[model samples]
Target: MMGNRRPFKAAIIEFNPCLNNLNDNIKHLLKEVTEAAEKGAKLIVTPEMATTGYHYENRRALKPYIDTIPGKTTAAFEKVAKHYQTHIVIGMAEVDVEDGLYYNSAVLIGPDGYIGKYRKIHQWATENSWASWGDMGVPVYETEIGNISMIICMDASYFESARIAAVNGADILCFPTNSTGGSLSMLQAWAEMNGLYVLGANRSNTEKGYHMIGASTVWSPNGEKLAETSYIEEEKTRNETTIIYAEIDPAEYDNRSKRRLQSRQPDLYGDLMLHIGPWDFTKYELIKEAEDVQGNEMSNCAALLQYTPVIGDKKANLSKIKSLLKDTAAETKPKKGLLSLVVCPELSLTGPVHSLELTAIQQLGETDHDETVNEMQKLACMYQTHLVFGMIESDSHALYNTVMLLTPAGDIAAKARKLHVTESDERWATPGKDIVVTSTKGVGRVGLMVGYDAAFPETAGVMAVNHADFIIVPSCWHGDYGKEMALHTKMMENKYPTNTMTTWDAMARFAQAKTLIANFTGTKLGCRGGSAIYTLDPIYGGETPIVASSDKEEVLVVAIAQTEKDCWFDQNKLLLSRRTHYYRPLVKKFEHVPMLDCN
Candidate 1:
């Protein structure tokens, strides 16, 4: 479709591209991509990893599967692309030279030749074993048809990934998916909220114990199910692939939304850098930081945290908290640490002092989403720090554990609901089931953190491993087994490549930042302590802390130099890396999680 108004002719190829069976996959892709293009689809989309099916268990096992464009897949597609004189967005398993690990990349080919490729920045399931994560952003390529950005299956789930693409002016978010039946509804809704035309092309078949529900479709800017692979229709013709044609126009996007870009506020989110690349030098300072008693000349960075009572009364608590923060802020103006931050423990505003706090809960307890969110923005701006705090989430239900990030510039960058609901957490909260990332010019991109979230190492580690500076964990610590030991295990197991580091100091030692675990100190219940500021090197193991304050409100400032993140090769040597060309890489894997309409 050209626009919601124009009835333009187009085709949607529900490509059942052979996974692992490259020769056949190409034979199929070449035929369909060309046929669809010739059938008058200015833009044609295919299923995820259409050229090569997703497959892989180990690096060595995957070596035989990987290949670059033009090797076999591209050579075949090039003819289709040129001869048809159309633009095509298709997925393939690629070998990045650095680590030798394969990448799920969607290469954009214009009629003239190959354009840039948008690598899948995110992955699913055992995908990490064979393919490393991609580093580039969701990019929209210009073509005669219109402006389009290609997004792989899972990548579309994250709001950050798509928002960035839209911010770059993508008229259509064309996704090549391989998903199960259950997830279809959610993806359709996503298209409507952003006023985007989502061309989600999913595959059908089984691989690595997973099978997809093939119903590729086109979603209009208003989210109308424009075209889907109708099983009934295909069955009649014995056709597996369905062609969905639609018209898209640049004007369908929300004009009001551009206000965010015209007034892009990067300054307020400066300290939010710890949200993305974890390896800033500042995060290391929090391990055991205290002002130079003798004025030993502190580092240029200040690691700051929210002030809380150390098991005391209101006045006594306020006095102590004020002194510590005031002193920290003055001593370290603009904070020595480049990554400035302040994390509020779950219920930081008022200690979990008593259950009565719940009665007063309506003020901003677990159930007060709107009010709490509003207050957080106010609190963050006043504090002049990149403030990320935890509080009880309130909705129709009693409560749910949740976290919110209030950028210093007074914007809400991102938020996360606790996925791992514990007894106490469940006592007042519902398990949060979504992932969000906020883009900031300062530290780059940061994300929200909730307590017990660290318990799902895969959830946290995968997010961190993919894209995130640091996770701002917000929760109250209880009786010591070292009660938080479970949290440590979760962190260790899910950290990355392999769960290598264990403790804050351990993470500090490994990743070069205490802030990675910088927020809290010695685990204690019935008392508030351990609030911190810090950074983690790109690798999860290298953690370090810059400045830390226990039970106090303070402005921990950071002055970080924008740094380049490490590529896959920096860690995995090619010989040991899993290159898809060398072996068969597993196609995408995952049963999509259910999420409410969080537009």
Candidate 2:
């Protein structure tokens, strides 16, 4: 407990089924959870499929017992949770209307009413015929007991599920299982690896006639086996009966629970739409280089993240920005009068690292403002080029990290702010919820996603579907880009040529691959440092931009061609061919207060 902590209590209930008897099943659960809370417990986690049991072998024969998430099963638990001033995470079957299928879902309810529902993503052997997977990815909930994440009977097998929960900072992870020994070991392994407390609620008996060994157990984040119901060890198939009881200190689970941002490389996911059309097989050739160019090939793009030190000498930083932009203008020179565009990073004028009171530069200071931009516009208008850059956008109580893009016509096209803020930025910034996209006159539809904005793969995916030909990410990061790069490289190694790879090469490769995601944002988070263009696959020379790691200011140039190859997501075969979840981080549980997040 920390200064003035709200100490919440939790218990694990032993569930045994009386085949299809909902009345008796309800009576037993109410008795067990009520007794636990009467002793001051605030939450009680129940066993998996305890109400109807896991006897799906005859499910089609007994459709009468089936129900929806908001039906009787959920209604019963809702009343119980509220009456006790406690919370309950209950497992039940749901007929998902989205896909017209039944799914094993866990519902959480506070004293008030329903909290949220987590439909099981993974299913057991015969479960496929009975249910459909939940497409929300993962549903993590906050409760009076603690910030919790649930994995149904079979969901815990995948390492990514637990990794995601730990990565997002879960304190108490509740697992409601309807399994025996082999499955029990798997749950224990997950809890130890994640370094989060877990409650294992296994049914004593199932309607399917399988006898549960009923070794209801609990484990700390570290793999240490802590408590289990006192029972005679027996074969998993043997039927047994026992009630597990233990007093757990929620604060103990809070140890080793710290979260921070490293590099989140979200671009590798293939879910985003990056082309003007979804693989219409249009007229464009794969340009291996300038020599391989066709009439329809568009020039590569230059996406820049401008930077100035928060407290350093302003004159020097601004001068550096000017020199960098000048070089960038020279590099994106388009052939035959059609220029490549420049999309700049957010807060390039005044540093994004400081408070509004310190770094808010309202104007570019006369000569520094329109004078420099006029020069940029003249170059764009002269060389027939474009640029989307950033400036200090401020008004009253706020300042924004904006992207300023100039077309060949030499005018501002689009602007947006960083949508999310971590602890490091909460003291200084506000949130931008929606994304911004602009249709550049000749360049097609282009979108903007700030640094933190890219961490969520959906941001890019949504833009891609809406008509974005390309996306710009101008970022600044102090997190680990090495491990993520290595991970992504290993995943895509066999699928694509290694080309040039040191740790730096892999970092750049993963960043672009993640962003160019055909259907899902590839591992949506930043995995490398530096800034550059993301050319979708089949455009030739691979998918990433120039790998930039040095603190020194520089400009990167990429020529994006208008190709006939469709965006990956629309082409299921293409998406299936590549390992989209490339380079995922996996780690053992650290057991300490600050747990390991596969970093």
Candidate 3:
């Protein structure tokens, strides 16, 4: 029981923790533990602040409720662990008797004894009241089944914590959370990104007037929702407490664990590590963008298809894209001379987004000469229209997030790789170098960006400098619709928060460029489906700038005039603003500075 290295079942308890009532909470928890162990779970996990509950007034109010590491709470769970021959992770408010500090902590109790504890490093909004930031760092505990590590609720928000745990050889990243919506995808993404199993134990029901949405779930390393218990389902079943069970095999994660870390580009990610705070603006040279004269007439009609992509199914994905292209071509045949290009979502061939198996991705990865690209090229030639789509491009050693442009003659006119890649992308694909803008027979100079590249202003800035008349964004922005939309709104506002502008609109209008954004739509990816076409001026005669937008799968065809008009937002001259030298912090590395120091 102390040392067994075999695949075993695990359980995550989703229950309501009574505020400041450890007795009732422990009794309910033990009941779940008994049932889980009876059902053959070798490891069991619980939600954050499982015994003491979350939300305390302050340190003074919380200290009385906080207990020591091997205090009465763990002692009780220890008995259960010993009785069941299983390991248990229990979350509670921890009081360091020596240091006299409180922490949001999770303790690992094995059959042998108390294994270890992990303090929650990243604190959420209200948690700063009593909890001190964790100092133990991310430490892993080796057991017979696998190497295990614990991360409290807010810690999962930062990808670095999970990355740190995985880099240190953690097979299972156990999470104790009091989280609700918008956090689920982040958990799933973390599991897929790190190639480690995740047990997300979230609290359910109302606590002191605050409702915690319970969706306790377990995710496989590949981002598969192995088992889950949602609040809606539980309410229908009239179940106040639920335990989601899963079977984990450490061997399943071995290959990806090595591959994902190997693919990380830390050298290019130094900017991410740099933290910025309020600074003196007068010290830096501030220059407004110079006004630009409207360029020559460059009108071209385009179609943006917000179709769903099938994950890891290359043949099926290609067939879908081809069918859509053919259908779109037929619909626009009467105006064939007008429609210049069709844009598809990122990784349209093998799925715009996926928490895919590394081996499957490598096998499905296609080279430029592969049949995948040739088929798309043929489609472009047959229609006599340019086509741009995303796919997994691979060479001998690496995979790339690539967008391929096909001319009407069936030739690969341009290939642009995604420069800014997410953790999910880094799991399998290598980040691309350099922004590429290429001239098409009818489409004018077009710049390509994939997914998160939209987050960086410099990406669009560089493309704008190249005289691009149009930018095609192929995105795999997957998550809950409302939550992802909120995130996008926040990201778009970070730089220009006071203006309340969409990043895509700002990027397009400020750059004096038109944009055709193609996004995937489906429950499979859980991505917020935001596909639209934007121009400087409204074509439909509405105040809104977007020409066409779709929340679901649809063919959005928009006809643009040949003349490129100066963008409405361009009147502000933000794009032409020449403070390039003053923006050194964006490209150069800087030490982590507290955005707001409370000293």
Candidate 4:
């Protein structure tokens, strides 16, 4: 797809449709599209439901605005697309005359006329009252500008909708949304995670009681904010139309998609298709609460110990681990019928393998019955707390980077090998082949993931689909990596000041699970401690308070209750709303596609 073609310009229109006035809305959209096309924008997109207002009470209230795909809206936009020799994507309310059903849809038109259409597959709460679930699967259209795909507002909340399009060879994703706060972060994550350009066109002004937050944005494949609009309420209430533009060169980001696709392990993602509702935990009794537990009981406490370990020094690292465990136990008194989980960074037992030789690294590996495990088991039993930490495991003729969960019963509850090994681990470690999730007495089901595995969404998605209440990541994430560096530069340039922590938070929110991340501090391998517990607010999405984070050694603890989990599942049925049938491409075997340059 990347030839000698030059970079092409794309535009997004932040529109405010007049309620029950289809004529006025269409006229406004046409004027904006024509203006963008006149300015040499090869592609232009509008906000979702651009022909009709977003919030209607029921089908009867929205009935007047419903029309066929090529009936009037597409016909109006087609003239502009053909006149300027460009492509246009517009969102509208569609009615299937054959069945008399309604849908929230996005239609694409080029110089040749109507290209294709995509309905809102994942509907928001209000949309369920009138619109039918999208029957059309994700579609990508071929054009001279790029291979383009469209997703409505709520569809961007789930990674699967965008992942499927990327896997099918989509270079750019057009997002037509009416979402408010926290949408910018979601768009950036989607763009970086799938390695594709994302153009978000969000509406302005208030519809009914729903106030649109107008931060229409353009994001590059590396998660850089190429362009964006105002999110101020005062500005949005003016109902002013805004147009933003960006120049995209698909060739520059070809390697990112190549590496992302090449690193995927689809065989481990079968659980994604399972219909696992959140309430299924109760039926399965995944988290066995104590019999004496009261309805208003305080939540269990979890802690993260962030510290740099000496390379190849197992004795010092193990001693430091014991000291930290002892101090934390003394501070936060462990109570009966309550759970206490403590996590440490990756390879906390034997330190990182940065400058160590293969033979030296192998010698640092510990077995199940080694003194290192014995000492940790003693600490777990003595403190009456569940302990999670990473270590280099020595097996028969092989060494693996492994995370072990030691229950308060003085036994190894679960051990997971790193599934996605990094460059350092590749020198002396073998990649794990499966995802691990285990049911603890008080923590519900706990999923285990090592450092690099957190970078892949499928690892966490599989666990959440299998009903994991909490996901623990033992990471040694560095700031010097190429992708991380790019993202950091972009965040600073935009005054956002976020890091890879947003990635972890986004994964937790999409999975509807709480995530506890433990990372090493100090300069070893450029790892700066950012260990924190990420929580989900059903109304506000992922929120990272960063309970305890620093560039130095520290012990961070936070109380997590069952109420939060219950509230999330009760209010937001995110897991139950998944359209699994359309996720088949995610689990398919990988093959090189040179034309798409994803090898």
Candidate 5:
């Protein structure tokens, strides 16, 4: 309706479940669906485990609420759908009639009858106890309304689930979730990146001390939020329920999807299907060979420093970097003498400004031949270590948030501008054109990305395919650093957190390469540094991941031996296993798209 002719009206229901009471929940869902249909909603969606309720005491206790599809619950919903001529999607505890196994699943019903279902693939914390792992992968259903797919709760955390469905020709992704603030960022990301509408329905109210915060929402392929419920009210009271609706044209998404597929570099996504296996050393032995190399011969050691720069002070910022580098060299000279490389946060030279006025940020920017870069190059040569830093670059017409990599010889190796520009960045900087991986004399292939660029996997995939030994990310994250780290730790657990495309996930997803991420510290320019070094392969008999100070200036120096062997993938098999032709759907360029702000 907004831009296209034949619009499809879709509705999402957000309400409190009756808690293990299947009958009452079903009745409530049916009422909501009926109301949605009367209001002209062609398709309606409900929250995860809507029928049976979530937060079960035990798997055995959940048996009574679980039933097979086409059973009593589906039959009831089907009758209503048929009467209203509306499509319905709801989550339930599904039981396999033959094997007696249960699954956290979502069922789809149309006017005709039972359509299809999607079992939750990536189970959350408590789910693994009750529901068996999902057997069916991502499945898309075709009907008169549109090509629909479902991803429940934790499944939305996995970008691959949404990607696989989109690649299989899904126009709308219906997500039934029993989650909180953590995943809302990803919901809109999936929609805009895949060029499809996303309908997210989350449960509200408290269940057995476990609170479900509902912010049921919908987004267009262009990354615009069509409608969203109040997350604050949902968390406060059970009386607050939202049944929001939006009108979308499937043809718009179809055209966008075609453009998206045409722009993908599928040949570079070989690691998309790779399983880094596990962190347990049972499968592969640690390379003890690096230990025998002795003294200054260690080529793998690197340093990632957390620095805070004075805003708008280009001279002060350069002095701070020089001081940090000098201190690092002095401290490490007693050990391995010098680290192979050193990395700093984004906009290191100019500091960071969250404004676009040319006068405000332009004065801080300099040409590639500016004295700031030359000084950094001299430092790289002085320490005989590769130096990577972030700065604002001016090229006559535009200013850019750029990352520059300098060789140990004090010569420029490669420079890349940030491709994913933030709203604030657009006011002053232009986006980079492509993902570039530059080879170094001793560092193997090195890839450089700035700030938000790490949020997109395609950028990392391009670097990974180019055989980068490790990727350096210089970021100045703006948020509650304490909360972000806590959430990251809780969400990741001990499992190799590589299932999604977030900065932390990308580290594990591209485990073959050591990912060194550095950020600015303190609240000066609104950054609380949480620098980390991620390596799947253990170094020096300990887990390779380490987090620096949460809100203070710190340096994370770790020994990452340069290895010719693709330790995680077995001779670069991760890059070799990709089905290049099948990934055309992801070919479309999504870098320049600004991220949707979370409500």
Candidate 6:
């Protein structure tokens, strides 16, 4: 058994295979595996459909390339694994000969021979046209090197795939993909959020009409890139073969993984399992068409107030907030039928607190009936808009970091206490239990989250499952902290800064929801004020923030159109595509993974 014996090498092979050329592709894959194994890589992975290639016209076109487990392809890979005494993961189109079913699958081969396989669960639109939905659930295999899990190309787009692997005790997530855009950021977010290593082996060059960006990468548990291939836009440079390696030490960040598991409130994630969207795949029927969908035609003018709050000075902060609200109301008037939404940063009333003392927390905390809330309600009424902002709420003896929504009707529509709290918040604030989504006059259903809560995909996922049209975030988020900063820097360098708007952008794309984040500009308090609004980009199948703020105080306003026409597939097709029955691990209490020493 390879029991926690220091750090071992892991390799990701980025290769572009010829369509339907199985023999040549297998020969090339074997050569790469041999080279990586000789270079001391105990764990080696290849891109999705490495042997057969991606983007087939239909099932008949792919049928010739499909092989059953323990078939010829597995036999060839098993020889390499046994010879090198290494574990190899390869993506291929698998056919269950008995059932005559085809699936996009990844097979894991150990030194002993065939170990296990994970069928791609979440299918992209193109994949749905041919491959059947993965029937085998996400599985983690206990190996001497540590627990390992495998997920294919499109599965990386969904948070539940990685989250399930993590909860199942996977130390390393091997992702083999033929994905084109924004793939690295998605992998990094998965690594950071799940607190596990993500090794993505992506193909290079264009297959058919789909251009796969060759940036195979290995991410540490902290989401830091250990190694990555260059992502050149030039078609010629994109086809180059590359092999990136990173040392895998499963125990290095086991604590972070353990903490994430312990902090998960699975009971509150019931929505994740329910078919609660416009279309229900369980019934194989469309509940609403694009035009018939409620709130699709409604456009709301939204303003994000990015400003530093005067610490411990609620009166001053309220004055500045009110001034901004008044200016926003006057400057950007919504159309006659549209509504307006104004969002403020987390702890906008009292700012971020440095004191950990209970008395200090209690003194700074306010109730829904407090003068500050009443003042905000008055502003909402006066401006004839919905106001969203964060504050410290004192409910009896407990202190919670909460985001409140005040409607133009002069009422508190919804209040969502932050479910995922930072270390500093643990000293003075209690983590909330419920996820809140409120239906409004024109905004449809608006969901609420605060600062760090947006970092967790499940939080937004719950809101999305509840059919939230707009997910508003009141955050004091800083740009310099967290492992995501590495990804943020990389994204900024690539001129795709919107991809760095926290994990909310990815969630917005997956959940088909609009996300508006308002943040503070207090450098001293670790807030860098990168407030923005993210929406689904139909052209690229990703997300782009329509309006963004710098590290300075400013009120940015834009008209946000929430439409079902921008759905990932058909009207609400991505929502309908979710295989919730296979997601039992997500809502269950995490069990102790045997491979890692949590203590």
Which structure among the candidates has the greatest lDDT? 4
Per-residue alpha-carbon lDDT of candidate 5 for residues 238-280, written as tens digits (9 for 90 to 100): 6445799999775565544334444444544554444433352
The weakest ten consecutive residues by lDDT in model 5 span 480-489
Clashes (backbone N, CA, C under 3 Å), per candidate, total 97, 47, 9, 0, 5, 0
lDDT, candidates in the order shown? 0.51, 0.51, 0.68, 0.78, 0.70, 0.77
Candidate 5 deviant stretches above 4 angstroms: 1-5, 233-235, 254-258, 279-377, 383-386, 389-599
Top candidate on TM-score is 4
Query: What digit string (tens of lDDT, one per residue) describes model 1 on residues 1-599?
Result: 22223334555677765546777777877777777877876677777778667766766765666777545666667677788776777788888766665788887776777876878765766577877777666676766555678777756434345545655666678787776532242444445434457787777556665666666777765556677764322223222666777765445554322222332222222221223333544434421122221122232232445444453243353444446555766666553532345555655444553354445554445443354466556655665656566555666755656666666776766667766565444455656656555554334445555544443223432344323444456655442101111111112212322212122322221122123332333234443344443334322333333433444444445433323235222211211221222111111222222211212
Q: Write the per-residue lDDT of candidate 6 for residues 1-599, one digit (tens) a residue.
A: 44655789999999888889888889988988889999989999999889898878789988878889878999998988998889999999898889888888999999999999989998876777678899978999978787889988777666788888888877789999887655555787788777788899887688777777677889888777899887745355466578988998756647564465666777878778876554445323212322233453445677899888888888999999988877766666544234478899988888888644667767888888997788888888887888898889989889999999988887989899988788778888899989998777655578898888776677888877766777898887764223433442323222455325536566666566788888888666767777777666522543346545455778877666554364444315656667888888888866655445524
lDDT for each residue of candidate 3 in 1-599, tens digit (9 for 90 to 100): 11454568999988777787778888988898889998999989998898887889898877667799989888898888888889999999988989888889999999888999999876776787778878787888988777789988766534456666766667789998886443443565567656779898887776665556677778887767788775542233322788888988755656443354543433444333323223524213211111221122233467787777777777888788778777887778675335578888888877854566788888878889887888888878887778888888887688999998888888888888888677777788787876787766566668888877765545665666555667888877753111111111211212222212244654565355677777887875675556766554331122233433334677777764434334322312333332332233334433332111112
Off by over 4 Å in 2: 1-295, 303-322, 325-339, 352-376, 395-398, 421-434, 455-465, 480-489, 494-528, 533-546, 550-552, 562-568, 571-599
Candidate 6 local lDDT, residue 324: 80
Candidate 2 CA-lDDT value: 0.51
Per-model TM-score versus the true fold: 0.46, 0.46, 0.57, 0.91, 0.60, 0.89
lDDT of 4 by residue, 160-206 (tens): 88888888778889989987654444777778777889999987688
lDDT value, residue 204 of candidate 5: 66
Off by over 4 Å in 6: 1-4, 182-185, 232-240, 255-258, 277-299, 333-339, 354-356, 479-494, 538-543, 546-550, 563-571, 592-599
